[model samples]
Target: MKKQNIYILAIESSCDDTSAAVMCNDTTLSNVVATQKIHEEYGGVVPELASRAHQQNIVPVIHQALTKAKIDKNQLSAIAFTRGPGLMGSLLVGTSFAKSLALGLGIPLIEVNHMQAHILAHFIREEGFDRPDFPFLALTISGGHTQIVLVRNYFDMEILGETLDDAVGEAFDKTAKIIGLPYPGGPLVDKLALKGNPQAYPFPKPKVKGLNFSFSGLKTSILYFIQRETAANPNFIEQNREDICASIQYTIVEILMDKLKKAVKQTGIKRVAIGGGVSANSGIRIALKNTESQLGWTTYIPKFEYCTDNAAMIGIVGYLKFREGKFTDQSVTAKARYIIP
Candidate 1:
């Protein structure tokens, strides 16, 4: 007998991006993301604006996802959505929509943790991509979070270490802002860094004990350094844009790899996988690639589309949970600080 196909509709609105996706088991059929350009004017996300955008984008985004997937609502076995660890108002938009849709369709409702979805994104079946085996290390770096997770199973995960203050992506964007870059400057910084020297200017790394990380000190130092330089040379940023970006990227990547090396030594896990928006950085990608040859470790990097905030990652998690009969009731609500379980 042929196995039954499971179709899942997933939604993710943890922050500025409102996304929807359809998945058939572990394979993504269609992933649609509506990024809010309005936040670009503010140099950062405004919670009120983000939530309002989600409300406007949710219906159309879901419609497009289903249309692209060529599947009707009746064909969906379940609806999955991000439940938390993001802006409260943003989470509510996705949560309420998923709940109402599931009830209307008389299907199961599954809630996915945003961070876990980032890690599990590696498992999404793709033509050229390979999934990591059980018992591996996952470095999750995004605008709102930075965590070193120990993944022993699909749902079994433990955060070995995380940011004490600012996340790595926040550090990147904040640094970019200081240099007069536009909002959503993280990618711009990465693009410019490629043409510059990584050691052009050295920045201090935080001395956080154990596997935990800190970036507030580094961000402050960058601020002061830029302020001091531009005071003498008003055109300092313009004259040394690439070099400055390269140095910043180098320092941040070092901090992440140092802790990751420590985590590897402590746990004796040689396989490393990375996820989240900041994982899309060229510097971080290069650093992880070097470890494969120099340190004799295996590294897994997801496709670029899965790197940033998208519903495809959420759909993959939903598919996994659906397989395990991990459905939630209508009583489920959005959580702003949900941890990996």
Candidate 2:
């Protein structure tokens, strides 16, 4: 008997980006993303506009993914999509498309939790990179979420700690906005931080208990501090932009690291991994690496491409679930808030 090959088409439209990927078995053959620039002018995502953009981009993005992978729609064994913890409208676009496609092709449909996809991204096969072992700690930080999760196996996770209010990525963007920076200012702050003194301005760290984290107080402190400084000297921010950025980034990194340390101690798991958008920050990367040396710990960090929201991550999870025959029915709908069990 000849072995059957499995090809999966994955779609990710959780928030602003419309992405699609073609994965054969465990390898991702092609990944294409169409980022919504429409959100930039609005300082953040407007849910309605995001959905409209996804509707426009989804077709072409999937077409490109299939084309690049040299696979036809008929070859797909299943269709997988983010079911969410994201905007309702945006998620509906992808969910509807995936359901329609699966129905037309007479294939199975898989619903992937967005956050779980982020954690499993580390398992994508890559040369010279080993995936984290079972029972490791994962720090999942992004624009909307900040969490320390304990992973025991594929889809088996426990939330050791998470944000009490605003996420770390929000802390970064909000600080940037307060300093007169434009939308998507987190990366800009990171770039400027490289040239400034991280200790130039001291921000208060939240004294949250246990492995949980909080950035709401830090954001408030930054807002008030900036206001007070500008009142004293209107040019303070302009003249000290670099240092201020550096300080903010430094404080955020410290808070994240502090909680990660506690989680490690609590779990006795030295193998740590990080995912989500904020994991792309250079400072956080360096800090994690430092722990590998200083604390004799092992760390796993995804490539820049996989660090952000993309269908490839969803594809990886889909492939794993396909092996177990875990498929969803046509009735599965996009969820605005889905938690990992």
Candidate 3:
């Protein structure tokens, strides 16, 4: 008998981005993300505005996803949605929509953990890209999360360590803000760091034991360093923006690499994979590649599109759950603090 193909429509409104994706048997046909630009004025995401944007963008985004995939809603076998580890309001927009859509289409609903989706994103089938095998080490870094996970299997993951304070992305954004950069300035910092001296300004690294990380100290150091320098010379930041960015980026990368080295040594798992928004940083990418050559480790870095929050990652997890018949009932609601189990 020929195998039947499964279609899953996945929704991701975890934070500020409203995304929808269509997947057929593990292949993503289309992934549409409607990012909210309203928070630019505020310098950070406002929870209420993000949810409102998600409400407005969800329907159209989903429509575009299905249209792009050339797949009808009736053909969907299951609807998957990010169920937690996100802002409650944003998660609600996707959760309610997925539930209603699954009910309307008479299909099953699969609940996906946002963090797990980041890890499972590697499993999405794409040519010339190899997925990490089971029991690989996964580093998930983003604005809200910084975690080192021991992925034993698809649904079985152990978080060996995580951020005690600010995530690496948060550190970047906050540092950028300190130096008078615009909102969502993490990527901008990465761009400017390319032309500057990485060791120009030294920021202290946190001495956290084990694999856990603490960036609050680093952020404080940067903040104080800027304040002290600018007090003596008002144009200090203007005089050395690129070098500051490079130095900060360098410190953050070293902090991350130090922990990753410890994780590899302790676990004996040389297959290192990274996910989430911060994984897209050029410095971190280069650092990982260098480790691949120097440490004799196999590294997995997803494409930029997959590095950040996207529905494709959710869709990949959805497809995996569909295969396992892991359906959730309507009682499942949005969770703001869902832990990876």
Better of 2 and 3 by lDDT: 3
Query: What Cα-based lDDT does every candidate model obtain?
Result: 0.97, 0.94, 0.95
Task: List the lowest-lDDT window of 10 residues for candidate 2.
Answer: 121-130
Q: What is the lDDT of residue 104 in candidate 1?
A: 96
Residue 66 shift from truth in candidate 1, angstroms: 0.5
RMSD of each: 0.7, 0.9, 0.6
Q: What's the TM for model 2?
A: 0.99
Candidates in order, TM-scores: namely 0.99, 0.99, 0.99
lDDT by residue (220-261, candidate 2, tens digit) is 999999999999999999999999999999999999999999
Question: Model 1, 1-341: lDDT tens per residue?
Answer: 99999999999999999999999999999999999999999999999999999999999999999999999999999999999889999999999999999999999999999999999999999999989999999999999999999999999999999999999999999999999999899999999999999999999999999999999999999999999999999999999999999999999999999999999999999999999999989899999999889999999999999999999999999999999999999999999999998
- Model 3's alpha-carbon lDDT is 0.95
| Candidate 2 accuracy as lDDT | 0.94
